[model samples]
Target chain A: AQSVTQLDSQVPVFEEAPVELRCNYSSSVSVYLFWYVQYPNQGLQLLLKYLSGSTLVKGINGFEAEFNKSQTSFHLRKPSVHISDTAEYFCAVTHMNTGFQKLVFGTGTRLLVSP
Target chain B: DVKVTQSSRYLVKRTGEKVFLECVQDMDHENMFWYRQDPGLGLRLIYFSYDVKMKEKGDIPEGYSVSREKKERFSLILESASTNQTSMYLCASRSGLAGGLYEQYFGPGTRLTVT
Candidate 1:
């Protein structure tokens, strides 16, 4: 079984300020890590993913995350956030087998950006 | 753009009524999924299909059933709608690639309110 946790339920930041959303996972085997963002009343869009190779993964909208095996974490960071970046973010892990590929998501961290 | 289309943008159902939510994908993708989003709970997978007529249970399948009669369509069925079942439902599709890297595409979700 795999589980994901987003350490914070909400992270409020000002426009142009740096922000980080923390995520951690517990799994017995290798798994895929992902970040998704959801705008108001919209469905989730993939932000980034960590499969293999380099730990640093860059995603759309100038967002990125680092996969830390030692810490069992994959935290997302943005050098600067925008007012449009205000939305709910989710961290998820996918099990490899079954191609059933279940995504266990964090409770989510709402990113609130203000001017 | 990979388009995943949900049949309804909003739905209002009475308790104990039977409900059906439909999803369609245009990219000929091999996988389709159904999920529900609730406040404080992020997104929980309800069911998924990897191929025509194939279905698998997701993390939260207790109150829902699903069907995949065609390759590009997946439907989630609520046997008996309950107030607790009210949620924003999402449908997604993934184009499988070699080396296990796949990006999921999402539809604009359906907001279902069970009264």
Candidate 2:
């Protein structure tokens, strides 16, 4: 079975500060990585995904993530964050094989951006 | 835009009552999934359906069941509601592999409270 682990539970940062949320996964085969963000009382929206090629993947809202195959990590990063970026972020993984194509998500990291 | 909608935004149910959570997608996606979100524990898949009347148990499907009578609609059924089952329920839909990398579109989610 595959699983995703998000190391940080909560991150507090001031506005315009750089942020990086760490994520690691355990899977035997090739897998796809994704980052999602959820605002207060709202559903999750896809931030970015790494399907194939390009270890450095860019996402919405001026965010990016680097897929490290050697370390089995896909960490999300942003050059600077705004107060509106305060939300819950999740990292997910899914295998590329056939079957149900179920996605496994991490415990989530709460990004608290204060002005 | 792919739109997935849940039947209720919030629901209060009594213990031992039967609960049904409905989800509908307007994109005519081939796959539908039901998940439960809890604090400190990200989204856990309960059930998923790849096609009409075709359902599969996910990572945690102990006390939950699901139904997919049509291609665009999926319903989650809780046989006996319990306090521990109170959490945010999310529904998602995704197209098959034909469209290259499949990305799941999520609904607004239904917050269920069992008392």
Candidate 3:
């Protein structure tokens, strides 16, 4: 079974401050990683995804993530965050080789960006 | 643009009532999914369909059933609405093979509240 773990439940940051949301996954086979963001009372939107090549993947809203194979981590980061970036972020993974291709999602980390 | 749309943005239902959540995709996607999002639980897949009349149970499918009579539309049915079933229901669609690398397009979501 593939599972994703997000270490933090909530992260508070001021505007223009750097933010990092950590995510780790446990899967025996090759996995595809993804980041999604959801605003309050809204559905989730895709941020970035790491399918195969280029571990360092950049996403919308100036967010990026690095997929570390050995560590089994895909952490999302941004140099500076804006107030509009305040949302719930989720990390998801799906096994590439497994026939059951449903995405396993993390518990989510609420990023609270304030001015 | 690939667009996934849900029939209702917000719904309030009474306990023990039957509930239906509708989702439609405009992109002729072969795969469709239903997920529920809760605080601290993120998104958990309830069901998915790869083709019309084909459905697969996801991690949490005990209280949910799905219908895919058409290629572009998927409907989730809750046999008996319970307070525990109150959460944001998300619909997604993808246009490729099951195990291949493809990002899912999400709908605006239907927030279901069972009181």
Candidate 4:
């Protein structure tokens, strides 16, 4: 079973400040990584994903994540964040070998961007 | 654009009552999923259907059942609602085509309250 772990529960930053939410996963085989964001009262939307290409993956809303196979980490980062960027972010993983295609998610990290 | 819609945004039900949550996807996706979200716990998959009449239990599916009579619609059922089951329910859909990474698209979610 693959599981994701988000190190930080909450991160508070000022507007325009850089932010990083740490994520680590445990899997026995090759896996795909994804980041998702959930705004208030809304479902989650995909931020970015890492399949098999470059280690550095860029996502929507000016966000990016780096996939480090050695450390088993896929941390999400944003150089400059806005007040609108404040939301709950989740890190998910799925194994590439199976066709089941089930995603295992982390506990989530709440990013609070203040003015 | 892919659109996943739930039948309700908010629902209130009493204990032991039968509850049904409906989900429909417009993109003709072959895979549909049901998940529950709670604070401090990210989305946990309750059930998923890869095709019509084919359903699979996810990590947590003890009190939940699902129906997928039609390809575009998947329904989650709570045989007897409990307070522990009160949470935000999310529905998602994805394509099952081979050779392409399937990204799950989510709905706005339905907040269910079991009193």
lDDT of 2 by residue, A1-115 (tens): 6789999999999999999999999998889899999999999999999999889999999999999999999999999999999999999998766655678899999999998
Q: Please state the error at residue A54 of candidate 3 in Å.
A: 1.9
What tens digits encode model 4's per-residue C-alpha lDDT throughout A4-73? 9998999999999999999999999888899999999998999999998899999999999999999999
Output the number of the DockQ-best candidate: 3
Instruction: For each candidate, give the interface RMSD after superposing the true interface residues on Cα.
Output: 2.2, 2.0, 1.4, 1.9
TM-score of chain A of 1: 0.95
- Candidate 1 lDDT over B65-102, as tens digits, reads 99999989999999999999999999998865542368
Measured with C-alpha atoms, the lDDT of residue A62 in candidate 4 is 96
Question: List-wise, what DockQ does each model earn?
Answer: 0.62, 0.64, 0.72, 0.67
List, residue by residue over A1-115, the lDDT tens digit for candidate 1: 4789897999999999999999999988788899999999888899999999999999999999999998889999999999999999999887676544567789999999999
lDDT of each: 0.90, 0.93, 0.92, 0.94
Q: What is the lDDT of residue A104 in candidate 3?
A: 84
Task: Give the per-residue lDDT of model 2 (tens digit) for B32-80.
Answer: 9999999999999999888899999988898899999889899999999
Model 1 vs. true fold: TM: 0.95
Model 1 per-residue lDDT at A74? 97
Which lDDT tens digits does candidate 3 get at residues B1-115?
8889999999999999999999999999899999998888888899999999999999899999999999999999999999999999999998856464788889999999999
Structural similarity to truth (TM-score) of each candidate: 0.95, 0.97, 0.97, 0.98
RMSD over all Cα atoms, model 2: 1.2
lDDT by residue (tens digit), candidate 3, A1-115: 6689999999999999999999999999988999999888777788999988899999998999999999999999999999999999999998877475778899999999889
Locate the minimum summed-lDDT window of 10 residues in model 2 chain A: A94-103
**Model 4 clash pairs?**
none
Task: For residues B1-115, write the lDDT of model 4, one tens digit per residue.
Answer: 9999999999999999999999999999998999999989999999999999999999899999999999999999999999999999999999988522778999999999999
